[model samples]
Target: MKLRLILSFFLFTTCFTAFGQEKKNAVIVEKGLIKVSVMYPYAEGKTFNMEYYETKHMPMVAGFLGANLVKYTIEKGIASGIPNQPLPFMAIGTFYVKSLSDYQAAIAPNRDGIRADFSNYTNITPVILVSEVIK
Candidate 1:
């Protein structure tokens, strides 16, 4: 049992080092309870409306989500880590929230409106994930 625990700890540390985790202060750690990432993948002959996504969609999301949204950041992808490589995603929107329940409750009432507005952004289906913060 002791050996297994030590092995698990070693693996976790190795993975953390490989991923290059950012060092954080206590305040930042407490602020991040959960993370939601929405990724718009790149595809040949596809279009994405940066203006609509940033200006219109995000505003609507803020209204619907309100206090549930602790903080959010949107990033426009330029290139991948590989030299002279195309980016896998056109854009990524990350949301930090306190809990899964809060996110779900916020989505429940505004799910239809959010879904309907998707057509205004891009044709490609977005990839989304909700992750609990390890710290």
Candidate 2:
């Protein structure tokens, strides 16, 4: 019984150690392959249109550009806040492209289509940015 228990514990420890090592090796966040950023803007009188853009326009835009909408952050702006005050409604999107020029060209022509889709909003505008993951 003691030998059996020891063997079981050894197997469990081996499996756990292997899984932990795999997780460390498999994580690609710090490999400088992924891109990330925030899109900042304001949303005061354009709640409905903003929601429409969040749900409809962005998905269509992503589909058109072959990109992915990673996340969306909506916050109220502060008058006396820091120099880089966050926008009220920002749709953060990230695209994993091997090259920056390719990413730019991918969404170059879709600008007109995206503009037409969100033409109803006068105040709503997207300020897109990207950053590479650093090791």
Candidate 3:
């Protein structure tokens, strides 16, 4: 009876542990999907308003992209891999879309308005990269 009790407890623990270790469902993007990355390189005396970016800027951009925008992510730099080293980018905004041409068409009419709103947030001239998601 003692051996049976110990074995049951061990089995229960092992099952619980296995269930707890299950991996999270990750976002999956197809290989040919378009990825647009906007990076703001870090600089001394440069300013970034994370609040405005999150609340106003990104939403506005996403709205402009409309149905063409699959999904998006915003990242704020906090630390460098090397201790005491300056972080590379102040912030990064990336969006995934099905077609690059569709994204361009959606943004064309709103480009002027989008550019105009930049001053409401930061002074950084954002670096833009358009690429295909290979992974």
Candidate 4:
């Protein structure tokens, strides 16, 4: 009788635990989507105007990207995982587009203007990464 009660309790707890677990919503990207990340590396003497970048530069860049741009995100670095370590990047700007060619075409004409606007925000040379979204 005791063994039966213990078994029932274990089964109840297992089922309860399983049901109580939270499910995370997954974001699925469509095929052929391209992700562009522009990372600004941190340096002692480097200067970054977050306000100008957020308010002016990104909006202008998005305008240049036009309808080709699906969405864009900007992230500011706060702290490193390791204590007392310097952050690798000061800021990161990422944009998603359906077609790489479309993105390229959109930015091609405005490339010089985009580059010219950098001095208004930061002195750091941005590292750019273009990749295909797998998931």
The C-alpha lDDT values of all candidates are 0.83, 0.56, 0.91, 0.88
Model 4 lDDT tens row, 108-135: 9899999999999999999999999886
Return the candidate ranking by lDDT, descending.
3, 4, 1, 2
**What clash count goes with each model?**
0, 0, 0, 0
Compared with the true structure, what per-residue lDDT tens digits does model 3 show for residues 59-118? 999987887788899999998889999998999999999999999999889999998999
Better of 1 and 3 by lDDT: 3
Candidate 3 stretches with Cα past 4 Å from truth are 1-26
TM-score of each: 0.73, 0.49, 0.80, 0.76
Shift in Å, residue 82, candidate 4:
2.0
Candidate with top TM-score is 3
Shift of residue 37 alpha carbon in model 3, Å: 0.4
Measure candidate 1: CA RMSD: 11.0
Model 2 agreement with the true structure over 1-135: per-residue lDDT tens digits: 999999999999999999999988772443445463435465655433556655676566556545333333333334424556644544444444445565567667886876776665334566666767566
Deviation (Å) of 57 in candidate 2: 3.3
lDDT of 2 at 124: 58
- How far out, in Å, is residue 61 in model 1? 1.1
Report residue 116 deviation for candidate 2 (angstroms): 1.7
Q: After superposition, how far is residue 60 of candidate 4 from its true place, in Å?
A: 0.7
